[model samples]
Target: MKKILIFFLFFAVLGSGCAQHNAESIYDKDEDRAGTDINRENDGVRRGNGNQDNGMTMTDQNPNLLNTDNQNRHSFSMDVQKAKDVISDAGYEPGSIWINGGEMNVTARLQGLVTRKDREDAQKILQNRLSKALPRYDVKVNIE
Candidate 1:
């Protein structure tokens, strides 16, 4: 009985430690991706014709857009705001837009939430509207 109890306690401690190690590894992986992502965002902002001379780079000004404290909140807010502006200007009424911004990882799942068919249709309208309005951005609308 004594041996069995000791074995169980040891296994429990080992299992817990393994889980903590796994969590730390996941965070480390995200840190790597975040660094790369910030570089790309900064490059895009810099090359936007005259936006680069603002004295600060994109990642320097808005670190949240690159590596977020709360990732879902960060990405969701940015993607939602862009989607709203695009959809609204394309004849969509308020609260009639949904976006499935791409995920950060394989486990992160991509989800496009639309309240109605009208919302989906509005995305199509945005394709035409933004293409004409922001002709320089080369904005391609992919509702998927």
Candidate 2:
């Protein structure tokens, strides 16, 4: 009886995750395209009044658009903050960051006359730190 009660309590807590998720669920349209060309015009046949008694109405957000081929791969991430913290901790500061998909493009600059070796070292450190934190991301570190 004690084992069954514990299992029920665990299940209840796990079920509460849906309510605890605070982030907005936005769909990645680019990642939705899976190589195969889909003609949106011929996606579905709609009857009058937008009511489908025999079928389901198709929107831009189709459940099939999700990556069913590879469940492990995700299109979105929050690695920009990690890269910022990494560079800041290394004593090199980054300007505005522009992120495109999984790629992070950052530019760092130092005032006054600076040696080429100093710039190179800063770039290397940023690349290494970001790569280690986000292995799948393409890090572009530019120092000026």
Q: What TM-score, computed on C-alpha atoms, does each candidate reach?
A: 0.24, 0.44
At residue 144, give the lDDT of candidate 2: 76
Q: Flag clash pairs in model 1.
A: none
Poorest 10 consecutive residues by lDDT, candidate 2: 24-33
Cα displacement (angstroms), candidate 1, residue 50, comes to 38
Candidate 2, superposed: residue stretches over 4 Å from native: 1-77
Evaluated at residue 66, the lDDT of candidate 1 is: 66
lDDT agreement with native, every candidate: 0.49, 0.66
Which candidate ranks first by lDDT, i.e. highest? Answer: 2
